[model samples]
Target: MTSAEVTRRRAMGAGLGALAGALAGCSGASGPVLRLRLATGPEGGPYNAFGQALAQAVAASGHRIEIVPVSTAASVNNLRKLDDGSVELALAMADAAEDAVLGREPFPRPTPVTALARVYVNYTHLVVAADGPVRSVKDLAGRPVAAGAAGSGVQVVTERVLRAAGLSGAPEPAPVPAADERPLGLAASVSALREGSVDALFWSGGVPTPALAALAREMPLRFLPLDDYVGPLRERYAPVYTAVTLPAGVYGLTEPVGTIGVGNYLMARADVPQDAVRDLLRVVFDRWRDLLREVTAGARLEPRFAISTGEVPLHPGAVAHYRSVYG
Candidate 1:
């Protein structure tokens, strides 16, 4: 670990220890109560919903760990917050976490972020109106698209998909609206699509996102297939992109839609205590079903799946937790 990483770990350890001591003393409890801040996504997004569910599950698990979910702009923002020690935990896309570790775009330098688990897979949705002129990914060229909220993992993948489709340019400035310039959040993007302000929008989330599912009920929407771009994305970036299928009947589609899928990783700062991590992971795996109820449909959390966090190294606590399970 770098000097900065060591400093961050020490600071986090101190803060956690002090807080736990104070809480124990005040409550006269036998043990310390650990409180951790988890950075999730904006309102009505999968990250936010999942984080809330996880927090609730942890609270009910009879463990002393308290998870406080903090909503932000999603993956990129969450990782940045984790790096700065503002949050102890963050939910991020595999690509964003990879970039943070590799010190890619959006991150100024290599950040010391570690993965606790690979939670679930996020399907990329390139949504357009069912009756609109846009038909395919290429049709989005020169048209206004809500690429995702600023500083979101959705935007990171959206830009790559757009570039792969040959729509290359800096994201449109907020002041000067251009064909491909909208960076709206899930709720706002859905509203914009309803209002016809944006031609299409890019969103990465679990199948049947609440906002989009609700939108589908109100109006006819089409999800353009994006499986073709997955190969290029994987080739260019890390092998974090996969071709996944959205089955029919989801969002009222007549046929299944093939799209790019990325894994969502539950991340932590490098310096968090191992025992705390082990305890948290215990609750996570033990209550995995309850946690996924509100997050996604038809997903499973296993030690095998959780350990495949790609390039981001697992925290020492995570490794210990998994080892205890396997051994």
Candidate 2:
């Protein structure tokens, strides 16, 4: 080819490349959008389901909310995600958030977090099959138990309960694998117990969790009372633990069972934008009824009940939202 032809071809290629780069920059095809990231628990769990429902609700409110829901280990890991700025928002057990701020174990140092809202009450259920060998937390010793996924809030509560029950040194509970080796969340734990793979399972979630409710239909399940442990847990940790009871009709139990309750918080990093946080609070409270049809736990997120976030401070945007509505 002639030298002039070669030069012209090179210039054309350069021009096309520059145009492509400019278009890529403007469209951000290879870069992430500014949509907010919400970290939830393992897939198929209440956290995941609730987060998805919440994301949908927020998105439907307006184009201002574009949420990307991510499934991670519940609570503990979600806090870690907030710490590292990997996620803008997360659902966490109130106890785990307290532990993180206090620099407790599982957290090497204090991790700052702010409560967007007090979402729901997580009931700690020490569940077993009606005909299983395990009768109580004491009986969990030396038996295969689903202790929740490692690095999850459920596991933290489970370990604490075992310690409080004087069963800490008992053989490590069997890990309920979510998909592989990951610690099982509430849904998987119930499945493990129903399958008879584990003698007992420790699950912390909203009362009448769909999974447990469905399991109750297929077989009779029993919840071991843990009211005795609530006082100790509350005394040792923050006042995040409460002594509560699962009503007789819940989960098909013929009698009420005493258990501990921990509130769940919708948490955000301290630096999350006020406007975005404000929008979140808008959907959470203004359109709450819509969320109720989405997640059964949504019933617990009533406006009157959502302002009790314990030691975790509310985001200023949340504060404003509450004032605007309540005032």
Candidate 3:
């Protein structure tokens, strides 16, 4: 976890400390002094920016926070980090969260982490070699692709989509050693796709992802519908998924492509001090628009969409805040 800490700490005003401390299980989690740690994804990715915004929002609320901005393998690592107490907050995909909470055999032991809210939907975009024989997703049958980093949420869903699309990821168990996989990094995956080193790619992220955006600028690219598999995927996975469309020209692409995606959520260990969590959510909803303006393409954030996080259960604290703000 490569984390950039947000050292700008502040004191949560007045008597809120004792209240927040009690909820966090702290003896004195008191006196305008609480340093909450947050784990964010890679620098350019949405989570990092979102996490930073959260940290700043909390800080602005006069609470102390130690935001550990990290470049994650993505979802899988995020969940592990949270469950193990490596991080207090993490951005999670709905599918990954489901796998964790259910003890879904192949995934890590099910850990009942609480969800703060489903911030937004992560659109699964498949990019293939523009000049290669692969056009639609089906064309890449029996080929290699970057699912996502091992242990990252990307790999989890990548394999799911492949199976959903009637394909499979490398069957060689532990294809790359876990430790080896750790440093393999996203650049390797992106590079593999660029050189035709792989057949195609399936990434679940917010629209105009840096990788997709970069590839679109460097070479020809297309977003595969894979929507054809959505209905079946939904029937099986159900609530974790929903249809999200990448509007035409979003990536400056000529046509719109519909794909199946899951929501991106902020999750916390159940004991994150309800008062702190309570204050955090209050600030986010109140100044969301201003926060969005800070991230390059974070315009997708809107108050109306903020409460749409039904995919992941809202943090009881967040729900309290939401009810007060929008309910």
Candidate 4:
């Protein structure tokens, strides 16, 4: 048999098995066992893809998973959902986790949550339209912009960033945020820019985002430099926020953009069985490469960059696995 045929068969089997597992979980047919739900973002973004990959890997380990798709604006909402027994697992930015637990910014109320693992970096890029007058963030004053969806963790930090830069409107300079009707998921937001609906945008995501690839098709879009912002982010949000660069070819971008970023963590309700968390961590790092294939965020998933929890405690189960491999 040819290599292509073998690859196709493997994919088919995996897809079939995933379907069976999802059905079994929904039907309560996977025998009598504890169940967990994951609140992931959007329908087509990398966050949703990452959630599916995680479900697949866990399903392969004889566990059932029910994925709850939510808005990217709702990552912070995941915390409330987890706390209130609506869902069990979800992705969150590290800074968001810190502030949420401490009752800062968007949270406005304390949320007692912890970490399962440091999953991916949330690189903040001040993206602008190719033909727009805004070359840097300074030039953006009265432009029509999409800050982010309401209840979005990105919106929380983005508001602060705008204050730091003295810009307003959507990124904070505008008197009011753009209506949520546009629903700027990474791909949609970039498309809006290309079409001239939005003059500037801020995206907090992992490197080499597929959405950025679409925007890169525009020959002259620029990433606003934020060397100054990085220092404040580290100081205000915790040292986990680090300097980052969206490299040239990562998105076919003309030049690297200096920016600040934070981590996107895979977290769960504290009530999740330790055994499940342990097994999930084992399957994840073991098949890390396969997971990467399922989502572009995995392209930058690295153990070295995955350990800065600051005060956010790691799940005991995950710490056991991380120490075994890294030590």
> How do the predictions measure up, each by TM-score?
0.90, 0.82, 0.79, 0.79
Model 3 agreement with the true structure over 67-104: per-residue lDDT tens digits: 44556766778888766666677888878877766556
The C-alpha stretches of model 4 lying farther than 4 A from their native spots are 1-31, 63-74, 168-183, 297-304, 323-327
User: For candidate 3, which ten residues in a row score worst on lDDT?
Assistant: 1-10
- In model 3, how large is the Cα lDDT of residue 93? 81
Per-residue lDDT of 1-327 in model 4, one digit per residue for the tens? 332343243233322221222223244454534455677776666677777776777667665443444544446766667555566677877777776666666666555455777766667877776666887656665566666665566666666676666664344443533222233556667767877887877777667666776667755677778767878767656776788777766666677878887777787655455666777777777767666664544355567656666656666666776787787
Clashes of each: 0, 1, 8, 6
Superposing all C-alpha atoms, what RMSD in Å does each candidate have to the true structure?
4.3, 13.2, 8.5, 11.2
What's the residue-level lDDT of 104 in candidate 2? 80
Query: Which 10 residues in a row give candidate 2 its minimum summed lDDT?
Result: 16-25
* Model 3 TM: 0.79
Give one digit per residue, the lDDT tens place, for model 1 in 1-327.
443564355345543432233232234564767788899999768899889998998888877788989999999999999877788899999999988887788887877778999999999999999999999877776789998999999999998988776675544222222347588999989999999999999999997787889999999999999999989899999899999998899999999999999999999877678888999999989988887777778899988989998778888899999999887
Residue-by-residue lDDT tens digits, candidate 2, 1-327: 332343244233322211122111123343422367888988878788778888888868863556778999889999998877777789999889877766688898666677888877788888888787767776766577788887788898888887766566433345322211225666667778788878888888877877888888999777899999988898878789998888887888889999998888898876666677888888887766665553454364667778887766676678888888787
Model 2, stretches more than 4 Å misplaced? 1-34, 169-182, 302-304
Question: Which parts of model 1 have CA positions greater than 4 angstroms off?
Answer: 1-26, 170-179
> How much is 230 displaced in model 1, in angstroms?
0.7
